[model samples]
Target: MPARLFAVVFGVLLTPSFLLGQVGGDRLIARISRDDANGDGKLTEAEFTGPRRLFETLDGDGDGVLVIEEAAARLAKVRSNVAKAIENRSEEMGNQSQREAIRRRLQETRGGARARVEPDHENIRYGDHERHVFDVYLAETEADEPAPCMIWIHGGGFRRGDKSEGGLFARSFTENGIHYVTLNYRLSQHAIAPACFEDCARALQTIRYNADKWNIDKTRIAIGGGSAGAGLSQWIAFTPDRADPLADDPVLRESTRVSGIILLNAQTSYDYRWIQEHVPGEAWKGDGLQQLFGYDVDRLDEISDAKFELIEECSPLNHLTADDPPMMLFYRRSSDPEIAEKNAMDGIHHPIFGTELKKKADQLGVGCEVFSVENENDMRVYNQRWTMAVDFLKRQFESVQ
Candidate 1:
């Protein structure tokens, strides 16, 4: 209780692997900072358990430098461990028929699977994790013109979701002469925050790396997703360019920038304060943030500086800059009370996220549109919003010239 409470008060659990595994950094600082749950940027006795031995093993020399082979080996182990965890989760579910049904529902809606249509590329692997794959749906698009792409990330609060959930997007975009790609990133059930972002970034990079062969316009790519996926898209589009010119890997060398972004039922900020301030009446009791952060609220009086800073760093609101691409946000303006009653965090999809995001975009002179739906208009409202977003994306793509 005390350990998890430490997280609730401080905000966010430590995740140093993003630094250690991706771009080598101060080994001691990276390892200790992650284990340092209180976020003092230094490890305490209780927090000293993480990354200590792993660093030692990786740093074979008495010198503190991490070697190339060692880093690669470490990353491989991490990927292997994450993949095994997912497999274990599947076995634990113990319901083969239910799982099959979910897979069917993924590629098919009420209208049944889109048969007789085959994707240009299927199960393209972008990373080591099993979920780090994507499907590409290519239109009979113009030969003279490279098709603009829409990469959709699926949303399930970083816990339960798959890229196939966005399978419907393939036909919608492809029919309009745009190539569409739906991707699966690492989920918290197997991995967590940085894993999700890293997977998404790598997938985009992989697409760009193969843009020419795939007939995709590298300059006109648009990103989008729902809920957690939406947050990932915003983080990539708004966050400063992550292109590491110094990295040796070609994929890592590719740019993470996009021409436009679309967000649905988005989370504009991971900050608890932002959630509390913008949410509708009496929605403060939700602990969804804690789950997303993979923490348990301790209701402690004090906070951790490092943890708070990390949370802010991860929040898309904090990443917004003048250079961000145009964005279209879709959300619900109100909640169904009955539905709201079922989930403690029903207001997560509220328009407040879009409302606040619009305010920030206005401040930065970035193009941002917010669409709020108060009632069920059936697929009519969705089609309208989709049309607007696709038009916006097409305009953005054309302007890329």
Candidate 2:
């Protein structure tokens, strides 16, 4: 896990303390309860069907449903897989702190699943790419009452991130009776610019198209994630429907409207012009924005008008309109003096991103709440409002009128 996620999810720094070590059985159940569709302690056929053979082999009674032991076994398998994945990430992800943090999490899950929060459905493909996979974590909602859903995208500066990190958000939202989804999209290295954002849009449509099967209330859906994920959530949420209404495919016909959005330190704009105007001299890091849009500053003189329009279209700030959904953005509070002392591009976490978006939302009469560590209880770094964000999302779902 990245420090951002470890801190946000565990309510503790991903330092030597390793808060994940405290994970236990009940806590694990709370993580994966989203698919507990009936709020019961068992897994039904409607709620689970792992890689087929495993689920079938575990079905001792020839009945499709699984008891707690079976469910725990399935959950344990998920943890083991996740542990191995994180182990690989620790070695290959290129960040020292992130690598060490993932190593700690790897050790925790490898010790044995402390929490039985497993993906009821894993690696369900939304597109042909190897990275276009998703995991479903169901909430324990009443049989007749469909639950709202939130899709989580991981933050990795657009090049690296895992769908498995929805552990904290999955537990938080599913415990509150909201279905959760975490997905992997193609990275900038594989496909740049709009491709990743389009994958998210496609995933939302695919998920909503199968809403009836998943027991999701398609009308009450939201999109969010951390950093890059948050930015793409805003991209999808704020933009008009990517649906091709005339297309033959049913999935492409689904609208991408989200009732609410949750953003954690997301970029306000990907346009380099905005970066130049907003980022302070000391904090300016050409590489951060360059990595996403794939245009070097030195070559601006050679860029074309069509490319410029496409860049503007990719910027979340440019897409905001009155029709955009409710949004609650969280960031760490900082003083002007502190901003100067920060490392390059750390300013992306500064309040300016949230405040500027809030300004536009206020102008359009949209519901936008910008919270920072200084005033908002949920905005603290180590102890983020994982539950409060869900509450805000549900309120947005309920308040749709």
Candidate 3:
């Protein structure tokens, strides 16, 4: 083997515990055992094919021969050392921003796998804006009865996400006899608060308008999203029904009432003052705040009363009431105040948002459940939360029926 190829092969063989896993380790060991030229369970220097330096390293006891058992033990030690080095480096270098970036990349990769289940209807326009289009995945149900629907909106702090992010939830919901719809709305770059909110509202109304054709249960619809999208879902769910029965536009006549809502790492309020008061940090100072509200960030201290009214109006918490749909909120961050106050992103998606919302929901006798991960790195718990969200939505639909 060429020096590079030999290095690659040896690298794979040495790190089998980490790179190839247990099954792969077995196969590699078998391959190495085949090189036992003298029918012994060990390889002498004459039989070893890799560099002398590597053989010496694997020998572990300065022995002239490489015993398979000893080599396996050495590999395990190497794997442990590599893992510790990575863990230490991560602890030293991992900041919220870098972690968030890694999370986005992972989501993007998983989002690609989700994209495999193509939409039944793609780019169906609900309004004049280009971003007003939505993709629908009709339920795979056999019954004639209309199926409950779930609409997902993407989150990027109102600036950077795509409706395709909804692909993550498409299969799970559709497989359970529920219709799934994912949509794109105007971002901060396109327009501010009410525009994105109205765009999503219009999309919901449009879906309701085509209820019969899509075999949708208009009354059993639910809305959900993460971060900015979660905030939008709450805005739609908590607000009074926006149906204009006598409107000339038939779509506008459709009710925007949903039976439930799922919020993932959601921000219940967008008002800077409310955020500061509840979140214990400068969450209001996050990027895109100015663009989101169409106000100058530097002049926030002197913001006019009219602009403050707009802020309050856009906040979902302000609109929540006893009559609003039941809600399920999930947060990846811990509820510890000190941790939440450590960074802008943490403060922005703090579990306290859910706690505060649940308190009010309890006061008003509304159904609200908040789940937070004590260990944010545990993906199993993160994934389980989403499973619980789907179950919660199904239960909500069942209750209403």
Candidate 4:
């Protein structure tokens, strides 16, 4: 009787793995190797100990047993394991199904999984002091007409993020007959204000210089990004003719005239005081922003208010004008009480759209549209926002026509 209980429990625990192994032992082994609790590269003694107990229960009627009750219990445990394996496989199938759907749709309209636009990389020096290179995504979108173009910047605060981050966005735009470009710039930690902006401008010039080969539509060009990239995108959108003409390159003569803007959870402006008042915590403190201006926020007074002047220069809000491109801002609301329950720190730092930023866009008559995402994970919201961006661009192009 004592060994019978152990066998029953052992059978219950062992049956699941044995069952799963029959169906997809290789897959089960792979997942176990990756996420196993003990990390012994294989299931450890502690892991198998419970299964051993279940196996013992399968030896009932205790005359060194092999009875009907023990066999029935083992069979039931095997069934349970089989059910669990099916459930896990079903989940994997679902993800594969989604990817196939997206791929099929893309093939129906555009070409295969390959990016529609051919990408090119080149190294170039911008200004006398700052030297950086950029990558260009291009295609002969039209035979006779000039295709609309977009310069896509990536976001990872000002410290991180790269140009070739999202192939999906590039493919989406290109498939819809829009040409686009993406480039890398000097990061914030290494250089101060205007260096990123300057590098971006130079990259634009390089593209324009070779525009003939790329078949760029110079008259209809736009810039866009998310987060810090959105901030930079917004800055370039509104600040027309900000590029220096005195620079050696003719590309600098070209204007950054985007007809519309798309921003996602972007820091619209860098007011440490504003961020501090609303955002709470030292995460958005001035020290980080101060680094952009080569000064410490604490030392701002001694530096003759240079911090404030730098703030003005770097703030996207300061660059906004009545003629700025139409703006679409997507943010979130804090309606979920369970946010903290799900995660302690994430619940605290969840981004909320500021009212004043929306008001500023409205005041400028910038064709601003603001929306809030609720009750869903951010990845879902990101998909929705990408659709909105596509729609927004379509409408903007249509209105111009």
Best by lDDT: 3
Displacement of residue 52 (Cα, Å) in model 3 is: 43
Per-residue lDDT of model 3, residues 279-318, tens digit only? 9777878665678988876777788898898889889999
What would the TM-score be for candidate 1 when compared with the true structure?
0.67
What lDDT tens digits, residue by residue, belong to model 1 across residues 1-401? 23432232112111223333332234534554555454433222233454543443333221122334344544454434333433444454455653343333333321222212456788999988888889888866778778889999877667665665565446667877788888888777676456677789889999999998889988889999887788889988887777888889988888899999988878888777666676654344444466555554565235477656766777898899999998998763353444333333446666677878889899999999887656567324643666777788889988987
Worst 10 residues of 1 by lDDT: 6-15
Which candidate, 1 or 4, would have the higher TM-score against the true structure?
1
- The lDDT per prediction is 0.66, 0.70, 0.75, 0.55
Off by over 4 Å in 3: 1-116, 376-379
Checking candidate 3 for backbone clashes, the offending pairs are none
Tell me each candidate's TM-score: 0.67, 0.70, 0.72, 0.63
lDDT of 4: 0.55
Which segments of model 2 are wrong by more than 4 Å?
1-116, 282-284, 333-341, 375-384
State residue 250's C-alpha deviation in candidate 1, in Å: 0.6
Cα error, residue 324 of model 4, in Å, equals 0.6
lDDT of 1 at 284: 42
Candidate 1 displacement at residue 103 in angstroms: 21
Candidate 1 stretches with Cα past 4 Å from truth are 1-118, 281-288, 299-303, 335-343, 375-380
